[model samples]
Target: MAMDEIIPPPEVDLPRETEDSERIIPSPDVEYLPRQTEDTERKLPSPEVDYLSRQNEDILEQKEEHGKTTELERKEKQLKEERHGEEHERPHEELGQGTKLETQCEEHKRLERQCEELERQRRKLERQGEELKRMKTITIVYEQFRQWIEDKASNSSSGVSFIEFNPSEVDDSVPKDQNHCLGRGGYGIVYKAKLRNETVAMKILNESSRQGEREFKQEIAILKRIRHQNLITLRGACSEKFALMYELLPNGTLEDRLINEKQRESFSWEERVRVATSICTALVFLHNAKPNPIAHGDLKPGNILFDDENICKLSDFGISRLLQQTNDTGTPNHITEVPKGSGPYMDPEFKNTGKLTPQSDVFALGIILLQLVTGQSATGLRKHIVDKLEGKKLEKMDTRKQKMILEKLQILDAQLKLDDTSIQDAVKMVSLGLRCSNSERKRRPSLEIEVWPEIESMNKSECLYGSDEVD
Candidate 1:
């Protein structure tokens, strides 16, 4: 192609230049050309330079877009790594918390087991202590018995004779019949027998247990030393057979008379009062015995006896206790691990504390008084009388108030056929009975100080005025 065909022609017309406008001057080597006619063959400029310039601008724009895309991809990768790391650590924290909870539960269970073990140990210790106390009591009683037997053997004139008679001779002398059996007790059976050419009551032990032998020895020891009108007299003993001989009382036990309907009718109110007085006299004698005061641990109606004169004689020295002086102050401490007595006649304090005192016998006597006045069984008799007198209050009341209450009270047995004067005496006796049978030991009247005086005064008043006097 021609050079002219490759270049375009310039136009002749140009704009006038102003003062501030830029001026253009033609080069010395350049030539100006006229405009070509339309009919002439015109050459168009080549498009290669403009195309190359547009391609370079497009490449720069593409490079800038690629840099922006790379920055956004880098930020997204960092966020994903941070989220993955957090997810991995979350499980470890949850596992640690779960392990801590399991440890706490195990610790709580261990503490509960330890507490149960401690409670069991405490109960076992209490049982051991009770057993120790029982063993100590047995040892003491055995030593005292050994000393007594030795003294009796060494000194013939010890004021109390313990004769060891032949068992076959005593058995042959006594008759074996139900009629001859005066009474049957837990320890033995009593029979009217001829011993040493004298009519006597013989108690043959049913069993030769240690308890029976001890009771046999204790009875001989006590009865030989004591002699009273209202107490049974021991004649002799058979050691091999565990038999005791006593002066026969033909009237039998007070329990039989109290229970039999015909005998209860014949048992008059004055006789009942006299029986009470006789028992009180016996208790006073036994309680005031010189060496050591004695307490009839079991003083129920079954243990009380009557002679041909119908005088009340206390019996059954099996469970009786001698209040041995443990200290110089004479405060007797006769404590037994196991208490022996009738349930209805047992003193409340003695049952709880297992300590026997003369007041315990007085408690039984109070129950007997209640039985004499009401002719009722000893079971629940005290509560029945107290509830009637106090109207369910049962608290302590003044003497005047109690007397007034007793005057209006109507709890006496109708079978007794008590006259108005006898009823007054019964009321006074009931007052004294309630005072003696108080549940609290301190509230009970002293046998020597208060009980004996009041009973003796009643006996004297009855003898002087014949139940007609109120005071």
Candidate 2:
């Protein structure tokens, strides 16, 4: 059933190497009958064999192309791996750089902190150095002051006992001592304090004060030996920082009484006349002192003080000097340098000549007298006073003060027998002030010669009208 059905005959047969154009017909009865000749078999190959040869050639060519493609793929994969590795390494390098930058920033901040700490230390040290310098200066001044006092006390003929003062007792650092600062000037600061149940004024020279150390020593030397009722009494002294203690004048300065409305009422015209006279007497005592005559180089209302009793007293001898040598004629011995006095009270002749004399003091005293009567600033009204005395009307003077004094005199007239003497005395005193303040040095009157006696006479005339009575 199987062999005959399984094999099928070819539809067409191909022939090779036949030169004759002949056709061969096969009988269908036998189905498989043809036998190949040797020549034909040699020339023609079988179909399966031919197909296998072609397949082998195609397989060889495909294998060669595939090998070339595989090589290209391997090269591309290698390039990709290299690129990825480069990208990764680049980020790692950047991370390293970032770490280095952060470290640098932290180091800069540390340096800045260290610099600030050093600067603070430097400033603290500078302050400590300044304090040490101040303490050293105080020690030197105190030693000199103490030595001078001992010598003066031992040799003095006045039988005055010099009391040694402790610097710590009057030191401003003492919390119990209330230092109500009164005022400050070139000389130093003055403070009012209640010490030992007694009110007193303490002047303390600052380390940076404009007043010279020599001038402070000079003031101490002068005040320690000199004694006068008209001048301020020196209560005590502290060697530390050039501190001087005096009885407190609750009424403050003459300038204060003149300027302040409430305080000015306490000073009557008769009192001002008496004050001027007493101040002149003080000048006389200073000028005629034993051994060496002293000259008050600076005189102004600011340096004059009033007590609780309203008695005027001279103060601030910071620029006072004992005459180098006294002239026999009562004029203070001339010095080469211009006197150190307030500009308003400075004598013009003294400025021109650069010479200090008793006449210079006289000029300052006259200026003070003019201020007292006119109630105008010595500096501000210098030209006015000059003009008024030179044939100008009395109304042209400070009208406020003129009216005030005249009213006071009129009130006194109603209460007592104030005749022409009071008026004449006032006119004569004003005339004397003008003569004392004359521009020429020779024309200025000495307190001993002219100013003192005239003021004394005026005081005597004023006493008859009850000068002690407050208006």
Candidate 3:
């Protein structure tokens, strides 16, 4: 039954459904209207079916693109991880270098501080050492000086006629000379002698003569008491002979210098005035001396000398005397050699009274001033000059070299008379000298105030002597 049923209608051909369309059959018993020309009906597939197929293809492509993207992303992640590992390892290498730098910087800072501290300590130590050395030297010097003072104080007869023939440290190992006398005066002679490495003037006395011995002791006492720059330096002494060594002056006395024709060329007007100023300076120093004032009993050109530096120093102290507080108005500082000076420059009062004072020295210096200016010895000037009808020496003068000299002589004739007055020096210098040489001692000017200022003026404007004259 099953086979038969299966064969039936086996051959009945049915229209196959096509992919492009869906077919539908018409209703039965419909009017055969000329074999009902039902045109071959075709139905296209539905729009929904085409849309579904396009969507399926799009989904498949999306899946393939996603796989490729995932593969590429994984490869990128692996590469990044490898780079991160390398970067992580590099930090260790840099860390080692950084640690070394840090250690070096710390060490440098520590060393710098250490060096600075060491320098500070060194400076402190050096300063302390220097201070200690200075203290030790000062202590030793002070102790020695104190002991010397104490010894002097302890000796009762230390000062009174305590003629200590002390040797000079500078001349401790020197030999003395008997001859080679540099100068001779009433009291003594000055010998040029060697002392140690230096040349000195050794003033010796005739000790056999009683008068000379007395004077020698007096001079020694005076020299020991007085110390000044203007006075002669006392290197050492022997009180018995009244010998004293002095710093040697290369040049000789003012007298020897002024008169020597060849050497006189160097004695310019400035030098002459300078010499005069030095005399005044020495006089002032003596007059104002503390304890007792001193008077140079003899002030003369022969006693004044020039050093190697052409500096003036008062050489002869043999005639010098210390004047007490009372003004020695009655005495004169002239001619006697008993601490009394020379004749030509002596005050007339001194010719009678034998005493010394500041005024006495001033008077003598004034006379020397005249001798220096005239370049004529007192004997020559007296003989050459002549008084005329006008009662002045103008007629006797060959020419009027200066106006002050002529006028001064006229005035002196009216007062003291020209015959006795020695017309010497320039007009101004003569005037000053006359004032200094005044018989009335009180009328004399101070050495510093009166003499030095004028001498200084002349010194500053000095023209060579004879340059303005009839050379």
Residue 120 CA displacement from its true place in model 1, Å: 52
Instruction: Encode model 2's per-residue lDDT on 394-425: one tens digit a residue.
Output: 43445445444545533112222234555555
Give a tens-digit lDDT track for model 1, residues 83-173.
8887888788888998998898899899989989998898898767655543433333234334546765698853344467897887697
Candidate No. with top lDDT = 1
Provide the global lDDT of candidate 2 against the true structure.
Answer: 0.68
lDDT of 3 at 179: 51
State which candidate, 1 or 3, has the greater lDDT. Answer: 1
Alpha-carbon deviation at 243 in model 1, angstroms = 0.2
Can you tell me which runs of candidate 1 are displaced by over 4 Å?
1-163, 208-210, 326-330, 391-410, 460-471
TM-scores for every candidate against the unseen true structure? 0.59, 0.56, 0.50
* Candidate rank order under TM-score: 1, 2, 3
- lDDT ranking, high to low: 1, 2, 3
Per-candidate Cα lDDT values, in order, are 0.73, 0.68, 0.60
- As for candidate 1, its clashing pairs are none
In candidate 2, which residue pairs clash?
Answer: none
